[model samples]
Target: MIDVEVAVAAHATIGESPTWSASERALYWIDIKKPALHQYIPESEALRTWPLTSDVGAFAFCEDDSAIVALRHGIYHLDLSSGELDLLAPPPFDPRLFRFNEGICDRTGRFWVGVMFDPVAPAPAHQKGHLHSFTFQGGLRCEDDIAELHNGMAISEDGKQFFLSHSREGIIYRFDFDSALGGLGGRKDFAQIPTGIGLPDGAAIDREGCYWCALHGAGRLRRYTPDGNVDREIKLPVSKPTMCAFGGEDLDEMYVTSAAEGIDIAEEPLAGALLRFRPGVKGIARSCNTGAVAKMARVAKRRID
Candidate 1:
């Protein structure tokens, strides 16, 4: 495998989500602790940041050039130009105890976001986080409450499966999903990282149905085939790669985000830097969440009870 190298000069405190925009040929990601949204242009070598007051968990582009972002207290449309946020839906969690963590949109354009209990340490005996699906028809409702440290959340290219990873539990579960019928079927094991490799953080799916996950403390990216076999693994210079996205003109390159929240400065000098490498596989483009697309997707959205 080709060696991965630094993609940007940034050193985010806790870089999390990485979203690709083929139209703009730019990658959008966020830093949780810094509470900022980033727009990175590869061609011009420009990395612009939009400082946010609250920790924005995740976001997707809108038809009107704004962004649907999941903030600490609620979901809102972020005006990219003015950085103003319009409230859409309030969060289901107690704003004082929990916050949104990771999220992804389905093929039908419905956004699925997961929350986590703040200060994972001293966690309670019961799970407090939930996975929520936001759609034009269903609005925002809890889909699953089994997650604690909700991390990786990805929808399959076929739109037939929903994958969610619980970092604290060290398990990734696959759920049968059918938006047309408002379906969310039983979940089964997708993959489990070994106890020592570090917990799974964020993930992406390739065109071939392989799941690629970032191991936070293991310093590696792992690829699992549809059958749950380890198909590929690549080591990285940083120990806490938060998430990754496939981008570029051909979508052949993989861009990864890392964290510098807590680490030995000397040992992990490049801990929070953005890294990229050729993964030799293409990824399905993310679905747009706006206007006609969002309206059409309502037909496929499954309403939660």
Candidate 2:
């Protein structure tokens, strides 16, 4: 398998999300603190960036030539070509109290996103956040009361398990999932970030059923087997790797994102750069949980009323 950690761009202030667009043959990522979006084309070594007006937590691809972006203030449809944002859903929660965090599109074309207590408020440890599932057809469904900070979300290959991370707690949990209805069940511990090392940031799994988690502040990624044992560790140059996604022509590469928000760039030069390396096993590509879509004719607004 091809393997190497290559610094792909100037460090983003807070690089949090890395997504591969199979259609564009490129990678799309975000700089949370900078509040920007980026597209990196490997073919021509081209990079394009668009600045956003809000602190975008996460986004996922859509068939409508746009991305469903969960912004600081609301959910919007971001025009891929023009970078214009049209409101899809207004602030479902109080913007002053919360903002979007890590989220993705599930195999059924339904979107799962979570929120975190406003970072500037009192310690997030005791604060309550939430994870929500949204469908163009069903509108939006709140899955559960997540922790103060949420990250690391992905579904298992069989569509029966849901993986989520409570970063503040350094714990990644696996839950029973109802793929047909997009419901979450009881959660069990999948892994925990070792003390004094790093917090679990974002995570992904490979064809081998191994879980790959970005351990923020540790400068490394950890691969956990199905049994929740550490199988491998991929180290990096910087100390704050935030997220990782599988992309590339064969989907064999793992692209990682990092944060430079609280670091001294001079001491850690590659802190905010996008990095990629190939893992032997291919990754499970994300899907748009369209099963929920086919059930509804039009997106009738509900909740958030």
Candidate 3:
């Protein structure tokens, strides 16, 4: 087992994830239940947060430096400089009963977002959950019908394979991806979380192609080979670790986020905080979104009309 240590204590409730921003050399994440966006710069020991009107599930930065966020109400573009929120367009179907969850950008720069029923509520029939791809021109296209809860997402270094998680089912699926068509096929089970550990949430792939996953209720982060063999476990100080990513100049440091909401009183200190550790594993190179945001904008305009 690899020893994991806490780097920072954010004390955020429902801390969702950490995304490496190569351009800024910083880490970005969110506090879903708290409805805030956070950015942490390791070198400068700088941490900043912006409050949002709605829960922010996930987001990716556009080439123009604005952030596109998946929120409970709909999608919107957030200008980090001016703190402006520009509503794009709502999801194609009714989102009143569902909300966005885990999401990331594809190699082509399109933002791929997933939606799931709020855990506090009973599952809705019309809401089977879905994976949607958003381009600046296309708005939001339902890409695939997913399980009731879709979480962690990772793309292979070659961009030929896509990994998605069914958090509640504790299973991860691998699909062959076609970059040209923005489609997926040949779905196969990739990994299954060992019973009793915890359900899987967000994940990141290292340069070795090994997947490192955050175990939501387990208070641990685990690494597994591509074939699903458990390799290492990094225990966390928080009981509700939500997601992780490799950041810092060398990409050798792992930054994790946790949630303070819904935990037993004993685990309260671990809730709603950001944590980090150095695992000495180099991460895969960060990929950029080519023109996906532009395409999504066009799609949003058409959908609005």
Candidate 4:
């Protein structure tokens, strides 16, 4: 495996955006601290970015080339072609205490997201974060609520397992998943971040079933087997590697995002930025957006019979 390279310089404060768009053949990410949405086309080396009206935590592509974004306040529909934003749903639970963190679409097109206590909000005496799964037919359904500091999330290729990480606790959990029933069962420990290493952040799985994760504070990206064994490690030049995904025509290129959250302004100038590398492993195909449009069609067809 090759070492990682800085694709984008440290132009933002905290970068947490990471999503793969198959149709556009591009990787879309957000600079959460900078509060912007960015798209990168690796083949042409073309980069496009747009300023957002609020702090966007994560986003997924819609069928019509638009996007569904999870902001600090709620979920919104964003027109990728024009950059227009429209509200979709309010926050699932207590709006004042929580904000959207990490999210991904499962194979069945359900959007799964995590909510945590807002860093800017006052710390409650006993606050616990939550994980939620949103289907097109049903609204937001609670999956789990055990994380202290919710972070990275991923699902298995067969849609039978789900992985979730708690950055603060430095542990990853695996769950038995049932997509049709919209429920998670039999949670167990998956991985644990050793102290002084980096906290686990965003993650992706390759076609071979290895889990690749960004080590948020340790300046490294690691690949692990399903049993939680470390398979490989790639050190980064920048600290705070936030997230990563595999893309490119052949799905060999690994894209990463970094953050500048806790670094001194002078120590590492380019703290929050985008990075890329070739790790020689193929990634699984990304799931399609099952937003309102696709979900409605399925319902209408079923009703006609």
Candidate 5:
């Protein structure tokens, strides 16, 4: 495998959520601490950004050229063309206690988002991260009370499996998924990173049903087979890779986002830049939140009318 190379020297503070838009042929990601959504067009080397009001955890593309964004306060509809944000739902829990974290859409177009206790807020005595799902037909619902720092959210290409990670605890979990009903069960440990090795961050599923995950603090991307065996590992130049996704025309090229938060950039030069490399396997195309934004818009229109 080729060594990972810098794709964008964004220097994002808490870069996360590397998402590919095949329709637009651009890669979108977020800088959480900076509070912005960024679009990078590799073809033209052009970059565009939409400044967000609050820290955005993650987002999923909508069928109608918009995006459903999970911010600190609520989920919102972001019109990509006009940069207008409209609220879709309020925070599932008290905003002061929890803030959205990793999120992705399933094959059935349900947006699944995870939430963690806000470190900036006062200590909530007892709190745990939770998983939630949202649909146009069914509103937001908290599905599971899962972890402390939820990350590494991904689903298999065949839609039969789901993976989630508790970053602080260094455990990646696998669950049997019912795509039709958006159900999760049969949870078990997929892998665990030892204390000095790395913490599982963001993840993606390849065409071969293998799991590709970024190892934050370890500076590596590890691929695991369907049977929970390590297949391969690729070292990255930066120590804090936050997320990875496949994006090139053929879906063989992989993109990674990193964080520079609380780091001495002078020592780690490429700490926050977006990186790219080839893993010799294509990735499953990301599923979008089909018609959710459009449906919400129609509802608001009828109310206005």
Candidate 6:
């Protein structure tokens, strides 16, 4: 068994979206229930948190040192230094019913984000969720297929394939992607996890093209090959490992985030802590948003000026 250690002994409610900024040499993640963005600097063992007014699901770093954030009401451009938010796109569905969930930026600078039924809202007989993409040239494009909860979102290294997970169904779906036109086709089942194991959550792709995913309820992380075969798995100290990301000066360290919101801390000591381990594999640098949303923010600022 690979040894894992606790990096941050945080009591985050719903820790998710572990992203590494190579330029900054820091790891940034979100606490969904707490509605905050956290930055951890490994070299200095320093941590900084920026409080947010709305619930945030996921975010991607931008080339301008800012970030694009998916919040409860809509997507926004976040000023990391000031903690200010500028509206990029308003939520298509009613905010009371649906909210943005998982998201990532592709090599072509298109930000793909997912929507899911809001748990705080009254339960409906049917759930509503969809996959959407945002770009500078095109505002927002929504996919037709729907699901209850959209979790794990990752893209292949060549940018020819997209992977997404429906947590309620415990299935991961793959789509043939058109990078030039931002299109998704050839949708099919990539993999499935038995309910007994755990529902798939956030995911990241490694240099070897293997998908690393956190098993939400099972206290584990798994590596799935390009062909969707499980090649290895690691047991986590926490039961609700929500997401994993590869980061380090060398990009060989795997950092995981967990949830402690509704968990019994007495039973699960590291339930909300950030955990890390060396997975013996280096990860490719993640693509950054090419200042598209930041451009929008600048436009808005100019108009106001």
Clashes (N, CA, C under 3 Å) per candidate: 2, 10, 22, 1, 0, 0
Sliding window of 10 residues with minimal summed lDDT for model 2 = 292-301
State the C-alpha lDDT per candidate.
0.81, 0.80, 0.79, 0.77, 0.87, 0.85
The prediction achieving the highest lDDT against the true structure is: 5
Cα RMSD (Å) between model 1 and the true structure? 4.1
- List residue ranges in candidate 5 displaced over 4 A: 124-126, 298-305
lDDT of 5: 0.87
lDDT of 1 at 89: 78
Instruction: State in Å the error of residue 189, model 3.
Output: 0.6
Candidate 4 at 49: error in angstroms? 2.2
- After TM-score superposition, the amount by which residue 159's alpha carbon in candidate 4 deviates from its true location, in angstroms, is 1.7
lDDT of 3 by residue, 252-274 (tens): 98888888776774637656667
Residues forming the 10-long window of minimal summed lDDT in candidate 3: 286-295
State the lDDT of candidate 4 residue by residue for 234-283, as single tens digits: 88878888888887888888888887777885888767767888888788
Estimate the TM-score of every prediction.
Answer: 0.91, 0.91, 0.91, 0.90, 0.95, 0.94
Q: List the residue pairs that clash in candidate 2.
A: 11-272, 12-272, 107-289, 108-288, 108-289, 108-290, 109-288, 109-289, 109-290, 110-289
lDDT rank order: 5, 6, 1, 2, 3, 4
Alpha-carbon RMSD to native, per candidate:
4.1, 3.0, 2.5, 3.9, 2.0, 1.9
For residue 73, give model 2's deviation from the true position in Å. 0.2
So what's the TM-score on candidate 6? 0.94
Candidate 4, residue 81: how far the Cα is off, in Å:
2.5
Whole-model lDDT for model 3 versus the true structure? 0.79
Tens digit per residue, CA lDDT, model 2, 1-305 = 34556648657888977988887899889888788888899889898888887888988776755667788887766666778766657766777778899997777778888888875545434466678877766556777756778899988888888899988888999998887777888889998887898999888878988889999999999999998999988888889999988999889988999988889988998889889887787998877433422113123323333
Winner on TM-score (4 vs 6): 6
